[model samples]
Target: MAQEVFWRRKTLREMNREEWESLCDGCALCCLHKVEDEDTQEVFYTTVVCHLLDMNSCQCTEYERRCQLVPSCIRLEPEDVETFDWLPITCSYRLIHEGKDLPEWHPLLTGERSSVQQANASVLSVYEVRDNEISEDQLIDFILDED
Candidate 1:
């Protein structure tokens, strides 16, 4: 008998809540703010981080009440995977949705929680500004090329 690798065997929509939550690599790129071009719909990543994001831990400071605290915050559901294009390319949800495997540095693969950071896939360095400190007009100044 062998243990089943749940992620490879199941679709995102087929997973239970625990399985779904476990998919997060915790790189926290999703917590960064983005700017979208109205005409082209091009989404640009920015250096600004959500107010609820803890700079040290890279976890939300108010995970449960995030929706209430920030209405624009996207609550990524399994069904929303395909539509959430703003998700970083390194994100587990986006990778799985695109029929790709998780990267070597993903915590699940490396068995080390800090692997994502070690791989330089996290937002720690880029996320120098907080969302509350910047205006929409200033977002362009912080646009960053995907790492």
Candidate 2:
């Protein structure tokens, strides 16, 4: 019999550093800017992404210092998993936290880091511009249509 995969067997809090890091699919949807509805507390994703993200690779150029450079950049941690609803439905961390399996295109599942990009599930397909290219007030105009 085959052993259970680490993600299925381990809780977010139980995984070690390397195992935790490997769970990322690298879609970069988290790098995009988001807006919240003041009344309903609903979050909306925007087409404007962080300028520090290298679009082609869908990786942050300054991974270590991202939160310092961009005040809004979120640093995902196991402790924050409960509040991960704002993350995309396909997000690996959110999926695991919610007791869901990684999507077929997830790097961990496919053993190919480019699967997310190849499947067009990456920010490269949705981003219209970098955050620095637009004014803060213009974020509403960049909200992605709820599909």
Candidate 3:
């Protein structure tokens, strides 16, 4: 008989720093600009990349100091994890929080950083404007991408 190793399910608060950080799948979907409908409170995602994001690596260029530079930047705190619905359905953090499985191409599953791009799950090529050059109104025009 094979021994079964039971993995403990971690809530956002229970995750250590390394586990929390590793939950990011490098898809860069959250890096895009979002437009929230004032009346309905529905959020619409745009293809405009944040100025702090590195397009090639799909990682933040100034992650540690992002809040200092962009005063409006929202930090992903443990308490707010479940409330962040604007995070994409494909997001690892959101998946893990919802008790869902990571996709096949996720780096943690495949051990390949480029799998996200190859699987068309990353915003690697399809994006525009760094946040500094774009205004809120212009985001509507960039709110594209079939999914």
Q: Which has the greatest TM-score? A: 2
The local distance difference test score of model 1 is: 0.85
lDDT of 3 by residue, 71-137 (tens): 7677787788778687877887777678777888988778898999999898766676777787777
- The per-residue C-alpha lDDT of model 3 at residue 36 equals 81
At residue 145, give the lDDT of candidate 2.
81
Model 2 residue 134 lDDT? 92
Pairs that clash in candidate 2: none
Where is the poorest 10-residue window by lDDT in model 1?
Answer: 78-87
Alpha-carbon deviation at 2 in model 1, angstroms = 3.0
For model 1, give the RMSD to the true fold.
1.6
lDDT of each: 0.85, 0.92, 0.78
Which residue pairs come into collision in candidate 3? none
Better of 2 and 3 by lDDT: 2
- Which one wins on lDDT? 2
TM per candidate comes to 0.92, 0.97, 0.85
After superposition, the stretches of candidate 1 with alpha carbons farther than 4 Å from their true spots are 1-4
